[model samples]
Target: MSMQDTLDTASRKLLERAAPGRVDFENLVVVPLFAVVAALILGALTMLATSVEPATIGRSYLALLQGSVGSLAAISETLTAAAPLILAGLGLALGFRAGLFNIGAEGQILMGGMAAVICGFSFSHLPFAVLMPLCVISGGAAGAFYASIAGWLRAATGAHEVITTIMLNMISYRLVDYMLRLPWVQRPGRADPISQSVPPNAELPALLQWLDPNLRLHAGIFLTLLAVVVVYWLLFRTKLGFEFRASGASPEAARYAGMRASLIIVLAMATAGMLAGLAGANQVLGVLGRASPGFSAGIGFDAIAVALLGRSHPVGVLFAGLLFGALEAGGRQMQVDAGVSIDLIGIIQALIIVFIAAPLLVRALFPWGFRRPDSGDGRS
Candidate 1:
C-alpha cells in the first residue's frame, strides 16, 4: 500500500478509538460527577486554608452523610427538605425549556401560600375531601395569576421577564407582609405578623407517620413525583409542550411555523407559576401549617440552582433536588459534629455551579475523559 493509504488506515483506527469519548449518557454522568468531585476538593482546600484540620474535614463530611441518609429518620428529613425544592425546581425547569427566566417564583409562592391559607381558614368547617383540593387549587390559581402579570407584560409591552419578575418579587415581599398583618388573616390577639394556622382537616397527611411521628415527610412527596411524571409527559409527548420547546428554541422560527408566540409565552409562564404555587402550598399545608414573613425561606431562589444542575429535565431536577436537600440537611450535622461552618455547604454548591458552567475547565482537568473523536484527517 502507498503512504497515503497507510495514513488513512491509521486515521480510521484513531477515530474509532476516540469515538467512545463523544458526548453521551456516560459522558453526561461523568461530567457532573467530576464537577462535584472538583468542588469537594476545592472545599477541602478552602477549609485547610482556614486552619481547619484534615481530620475535622473528614469528620465534617462523614457527619454530612450521616445527617442526610445515615438512618431511616435522617433519610426522611432529607426527603422532607427535598419536597418543596423538587416542586419549585420542576416549575423553573419548565419555564427554562420555554425560554423564560421566571425569577418571580418567590413572589408567586408567597401569593399561593397566602391564597391557600385564606382558603384553609375560611372553609374550616368543610370536609377534608372538599377542603384539601380547594386549598391546593386556590394556591395554584393565585400563583398563575401572579405569574401571568409578567407574561402579559412580556407579550403586550415587550418587557423582559427578568426585570418584571424581579420587580414582582420585591412587591410580593411587602404584599405578604401586609396581608399577614390583616385582622382576618393574622392570628387573633397576636402582636406579631402571622397567619392563622391551617385546620387539621386541610393539612396534608404525613406519609410515614407510622414509622415515626417525628418524621416530617408528607404526601407532598407524592405530589412532587406525580408532577415529575406529568411534566415529563407534557414536555415529550404533548402538542403544547412542542410549542413551548419550539418557541423557546427559536421564537422567530416558531412564529414563522404559525405558532402563537404570545400565547405560548403566557401559557408557559402560567404553568410555571402554578407549579411554584403548589410548592408554597405544600410548605404551608404540609409543613409550616401557617404563613409568616419570609415563609418561603429562599426555596424559590435555591430552585434556580437545582434546575440548572438538573439541566432543566424533570427527572434530572428530582435527583438534583434530593442532592441539594442532602446538602441542607447535612449542613446542620457538619456544624454540630465537626464544628465547621454550615456556610461551607453553600461554598461547595457555588463551586459546583462554577465548574459545571465551565465545562472546559473540567475537560482540561480530565482530558482523557473528554477527548473529542478524531476526524479521518486526524483533526479533533
Candidate 2:
C-alpha cells in the first residue's frame, strides 16, 4: 500500500479503538459472570470434600437461593443488606477511578454514623422532614471532613493515602470508643458503649411495613439508588470526572494539561468519604438506630471487594453489592435450614475474587468463551 493509504488506515484504527462504548465486553461482563459460576462450583466441591452428603449439599444451595429471593421477606433482607454496601462501594470505586487507594472508609463510616446518631437523639423534637435531612447532611459532612484530613496530608506532605488512611482508621476507632463512653453521648442509665436510641422521627421510614411489618427494608435503598445515579453522572458526564480519569490514566499528561494534581486528589478522597459517610448514616438512621463499637460492621472493608468485583464502575457496584447482599442473606438460611457453615459463603466470595483477578486462567479453561468468530485479534 502507498504511504498515504497506510497513514489513513492507522488513523481509522486509532479512532475505532478510541470510540465510546467500545469497552471489551468479555472482560467487563463475561469474566465476572463466569467467575461467579466458577466460585459456586468450587464452593460445592468444598462442601463435598468436607464430607457433606450430596443431597444435603443440594438442599443447602437450594435454601441459599430461596432465602435470597424466594419470598417477600427474603427480597427485603437482600435490599436492606445491599443498600449500605452499594453506598460504600460507590465511594471506593470513585477512589479507584482516581488512582487512589482509600482504605480509611471504616473510620469515615464510624464518624459519619456517630454524627448522625448524635443529631438524631439531640434533635428529638424536630419534625421528621427537617430532622432526617439534617442528620443525613451532618453524617455526610463529618465523613467528608475526616477524610479530607488524609487527602490534605497526601497533597501537602507527599504522604501515601494507604498509610494515612490506615492510621486514620485506628484513630477513628478509638475516637468513636471515647465518644460512646462519654456521659452525654452514651445512653442514659446504660453503661455500655451504645449511644442513645435515635428518635422515631429521625429513623428512615420502612418502605414495606404496611405490607409486612416484619420487613426491615427502608427508604435508604432509594437513597442508595440515587447515589448510584449521581456517581454515574459525576464520573461520565462532568468535566471534573474527566480530570480525575485523566490524572488516573496518566498523571504526567494530566499535569501537562494544566490540571491541579493536589486539588484532584483531595476532592476525590473527600467525595469518596462523603459516600462512605452516607452509608454509615444509612445504617444508623435506617437500621441500627444508634451508634456503637463496630457499628460500621466492617462494611467499609467489604466495600473494597464490592468495588473490585464491580470493576470500579458505579452501575457495576450496584449489581455487585446486591449479589454480595444476597449471599449474606442467603448464607443465614443455608446455615439454619441445611446446617451448613456460613463460612462457605466466605469461601465462595474469595474464590470469585481469585477468578476475577486471574482472567487469563478463566480464558484458558474456556478458550472459546470470549473469542469472536470473525475478529482475529482474539477478543469478542
Please report the candidate that would top TM-score against the real structure: 2
**lDDT for residue 188 in candidate 1, whole number 0-100:** 96
Instruction: Compute each candidate's TM-score over C-alphas.
Output: 0.92, 0.93
Error of 1 at 327 (Å): 0.6
Model 1 error, position 201 (Å):
0.9
Output the TM-score of candidate 2. Answer: 0.93
Residue 50 accuracy (lDDT) in model 2: 98
| Residue 125 shift from truth in candidate 1, angstroms | 0.9
Worst 10 residues of 1 by lDDT: 371-380
Write the residue-wise lDDT of candidate 1 on 1-20 in tens digits. Answer: 99987877787676757754
Q: Give stretches of model 2 more than 4 Å off.
A: 1-23, 372-380
For model 2, where is the 10-residue window of minimal lDDT?
A: 371-380
Report lDDT (CA) for all predictions.
Answer: 0.88, 0.90
Model 1 gets an lDDT of 0.88
Clashes of each: 0, 0
Summarize candidate 2's per-residue lDDT along 112-154 as a digit string, tens digits: 9999999999999999999999999899888888888999999
